[model samples]
Target: MGSSKAPSWSDQWGTGGLGSDNYEYEEGDKLKKSSSSNKMSSAKAAASAGMDKAKSAALVSADKAKSAAVVGAQKVKTGTFAGLKWFKNQYQKRSSK
Candidate 1:
């Protein structure tokens, strides 16, 4: 990786992992004191991220369960109607014979 002053491999492909432009941000002295968002502790940040991940996983599971239930209901309805139709056809043939 080249210095931020010099363009690097990241910038060549447009990924931009290279560090900041300003001197204060590079020093890490300005943003923490200035911004409210930067005040969160590392532990709190990790916990919040974990909660967010769990919430996302739960929602995805709920969506999958709902979809599965719908498919199951459709299958049951179709199967029941098909069974009834087959029974009626067999009964009709037997009566004609």
Candidate 2:
């Protein structure tokens, strides 16, 4: 038997190797994905769903923030314009005396 290299991190994690090197199958051999791969894909889908939820929540928060900012700015602008109008009226009344 050929002397094999010492098992590295893959052996420690029981994943065989960094990539799908062990998963590759030669032609004419019956090959099918392992249940572990299926589990991994399902986990990936769950992670994606969570990420999508986060993304939607962030978008909702941004929209709310934008709405609040626009409402606040409108209030400030309206108040400033009205105050200026009142000031002009007061000055006119005093000068016309």
Winner by TM-score:
2
lDDT of each: 0.66, 0.74
Instruction: Report the C-alpha displacement of residue 68, candidate 2, in angstroms.
Output: 1.0
Assess candidate 2 and give its lDDT.
0.74
Top candidate on lDDT is 2
Q: What is the number of backbone collisions in each predicted candidate, taken in the order shown?
A: 0, 0
lDDT of 1 by residue, 1-97 (tens): 3434543455433432324321123353222213334444665898999999999999999999999999999999999999999999999999999
Q: What RMSD, rounded to one decimal, does every model reach?
A: 7.9, 7.1
Where does the lowest 10-residue lDDT sum fall in candidate 1?
15-24
TM-scores, each model vs. reference: 0.55, 0.60
